[model samples]
Target: MQIKHQVVTRTPLGGFTLVEVLASVALISIVAAYFVHIQIQQVQERVVEALAQDVLTLANASMTYFSQTNEWPDQENGDCDDLIATLGGLGAFPVAVGGYQGPDGITLATRCEDTGDLGRTLLISVNFPFGADDQAQMLMSYLPTSVNEDVDDDEGPVVTHYVATPRRASERYRFYRIALEERGIFRLSKPDCPGRRNDPAHILLPQAICMPASAQGLGGYFFDEIDDDDDYWELQLLVADGEENNNVSDFMEFSGIPTCDGNRVYVGAITYCETR
Candidate 1:
């Protein structure tokens, strides 16, 4: 009788191999990263959209308040905090708009009180945030046609007018001007004339001079080089108490200049107020 001993080999069945475990971890990490990226993008888009909407709401409220009360919300030295406080006090600011909290560092650069202009001009500025490079473009799209028009004329040359004429200023659109640190300053200004220079209703003229770049990143061409017939005009706020036909050139010029020390840029807007 030959006793045959069968050898029993037991294979370990409880755990995965090193390669398999690593591959599974990589797959899960990729999936999680992709979904997380998607969520982040969605949130950013919502924030941009919400900001645009909120700014528009604020602009409209300002216009309405001026229309009803015949004056802008008063502020101290055109300070943005003071502007916000004044509006909030008057219940003019929006209550629940997401991402519309008052900016932390914005300050009002100029106001009607400063310029003594009949038309209310509010120049507010803050440090350009890390993620808000697209805000200018976004806000441009929502601007009213009165502010966002292509007034190019084909009569021998393209003519662009910036800063709505006094006639057009009544259309309820806010005009915007942006100054960047790296790119210097650029504005929307009236074209050099023999075009529409002396239009009786236009406040900006053909010969209006733009300020030169100074120690402050303040001076540049009023017209961006890209567009020949741009619609933005160099805005000059004029003050004439009880005088409706005041000359636009006689008033002090409100230079759209930014401060040199900070990483901030100036973003300003003009809205017409019914003073008469």
Candidate 2:
């Protein structure tokens, strides 16, 4: 037997290499980061949706109050918190609106009051406060039809109802607004009309001399861009059907230039065109 002593060899129990361990750690980190991003996005979406629902609730409440009392809850003026108090005092406020903890820097303003010939309309607005750029943009993008941004003066529900947003110093925050009222009929009047040129168009077009037909106790008038063209002599007017808040558009027609006394129009003065 020639020295039957076998050489003993030792091997490490752990089989993983250092590089492999590091790669595994990096992969885990990437997956965790991805999940976190997803969670954040979901949270943001929920926040925006909640805010939109709350705004709708407030808007509906305002419409309800107008129909019931024939007035808007704008006694508080441009102060959202104050306006909320006013609404609450009149028992016209909504009981709850999502997670609305109060105005919280939001602004509630009344723009273009008494729009259209339909006197004393309630054109309420909900404004986003300064520094809420991300939130406001999100809302505008999400609800394009309902949201308005960077609207010039005399451009909204009515011509004079400028949609300028509030700003502070040189740091003008992104402007965001929601008109509680939709674009209403423009009160058109012809030159040398009977009343003062309080027409909204006058704000931008200084030479505009039209006045609201309602000022003369007349029905609303639809604007006809070209009165000379018989094809476009249709008069669209909003008339209430003896029912509260039930206004249906009444279309009338005239062949030639209607006089200030309203010849073939809705039996009301036509102040939108120059008489022949």
Candidate 3:
């Protein structure tokens, strides 16, 4: 009878109300939004960094290719922006000539035209005056080749070409180097590698395999380095990017002068620069 007198209080068994639940959802949403914002910013930053790295890579590769082929590209006479529009191949060529001409007048213009895609002209011109063999170690020098090129002066503008009389590894794989400044380790601006097989037919292909760097760099020897006969000879090169783009600058290299026993001792090197 005494236990029956005990009173029982009802306890509430309710969970969160609708308003509180909604508020919690809203707070969570805000936090999620903040996290998403941070993620987006990080992604953008990564994208910009990747682009910068790509530019550097393209610059190095393009310059390397130019050295191998002795052909420049994506450079013209006018504004590079529009020029690059046509030739998609120009990687870092300054788009639009900024009221100033590049070293070569045509480089700015050629780099400014609109086209389909980036490309290179494959032209090679050679000059070998056989008679001028004053016994000189035939030396060839290479200059800075461009990624884009143009020629504006000559009527029916003549495309420039590049080549070596005997461009072979075993033939003239001796110590020869070319550069803006004389150096000990560089090679003349040309395909340092000969095709696996060295022959006329293989060398004439649209895209011939570049030769690897020769231990010496220069061809063994053009003719004789002795001036006993007093023969005056010179050889020049003109390389192009493709049939569309013309040669922009005039490249000049030197042949090594060797001293001989019969003739007065004469050994000299050649130095060249740009023409703007």
Candidate of highest TM-score? 2
TM-score quality measure for candidate 3: 0.30
TM-score of each: 0.37, 0.42, 0.30
Cα lDDT of model 3 by residue, 1-276, tens digit: 455567899999989999999999999999999999999766645543443333333344444444543333333333323333333444443444453122212221222122212223222211112331111111111212312123343322222222121222213222222221121112132222233333111111111111234444422212111122212212222222223222233212222322123232222332221111
Candidate 2 per-residue C-alpha lDDT over 76-168 given as tens digits, one digit per residue, 9 for 90 to 100: 364332445566666656444532353345545544343333333333354655555565666555554454556545433211112211111
* lDDT of model number 3: 0.31
- The alpha-carbon RMSD values of the candidates against the true structure, listed in the order shown, are 24.2, 19.1, 24.6
- Candidate 1 global lDDT: 0.41
Model 3 stretches with alpha carbons more than 4 Å out = 1-6, 62-269, 274-276
* Model 1 agreement with the true structure over 1-276: per-residue lDDT tens digits: 899999999997898999999999999999999999999777756654665455555556655655544345563344333544566667877443332353422111213323322233543322223334354344345443312223234311111112211233333334444553233334454421111222212222222233344453422223223333344443323222222334433333233443435334454544332323
User: Local distance difference test, per candidate?
Assistant: 0.41, 0.41, 0.31
Q: Distance from true position, residue 217, model 1, in Å?
A: 71
Candidate 2 wrongly placed segments (more than 4 Å):
75-82, 94-132, 151-276
Better of 2 and 3 by lDDT: 2
Better of 2 and 3 by TM-score: 2
